[model samples]
Target: MSKQKRNTHSPELKAKVALEAVRGLKTANEIAQEFGVHPVQVGQWKKALLADSASLFDKKRGPKPKPEYQSDEKLYGEIGRLKMELDWLKKKSGINLP
Candidate 1:
C-alpha cells in the first residue's frame, strides 16, 4: 500500500475556518467537512486566534527596549583579547604570517 501525502492549507483558509468556528454558527465537524480539514485542527486554530488576539492591542508604540547584556565596548574588548591569543599561539608554533 502507498502512503498518501498530507494536504497543506493556506493561512487565509485557516483563518476563515477559525473565524467560522469562533462565530459558533456551525459545528466543528461541519466546519471541518466544509474546509476539508480535521475538526481538531479547526478548534486549535480558533484557540490560537483567541489567545493571540489580546497581544494585538497590548503592543506598545515606540522603539523596543535594548537588551541589558549587549554593549559595543565589551564586544570590542573580547575581539582584541581573542586576536592576542591567536597571535601568541601562532608565534609559539613558529607559523610564519606575511
Candidate 2:
C-alpha cells in the first residue's frame, strides 16, 4: 500500500473555510470538498472560529503595562546585603578592599 501525503492548510485558508462554514450558505461537506479537507475538520474550524471570535474584540485599547521583575526597594536591599557579605568576607580574609 502506498502512503498518502498529509495536506497542510495555512491559517488564512483555515479562516476562509471556517468563515464560509459559519455563513451557513453551504454544508460542511461541501466546504470540505471545496477546500480538500475533511468535513469534521471544517466543523472544528468553524467551532474554533466562533469560540475565539469574542476574544478578538475583548482586548482593551491601551498600552500594555510592562512586567516588573522586582521592586526598587527589594533590589536595593539585595544589593546592600551583597555588599555587607563582601565586606565581611574581605575582613575575614585580611584583604583590605578600598
Q: Model 1: which ten-residue window has the lowest total lDDT?
A: 65-74
Q: Can you give the lDDT of residue 40 in candidate 2?
A: 99
- lDDT agreement with native, every candidate: 0.93, 0.94
**TM-score for candidate 1, residues paired by index:** 0.66
Model 2 C-alpha lDDT versus the unseen true structure: 0.94
Residue clash pairs of candidate 1? none
Across 1-98, the per-residue lDDT of candidate 1 in tens digits comes to 99999999898998999999999999999999999999999999999999998999999999888765767778888999999999999999999875
Runs in model 1 lying further than 4 Å from the true structure: 72-98
Using alpha carbons, what is the TM-score of model 2? 0.66
State how far residue 90 of model 1 sits from its true place (Å).
21
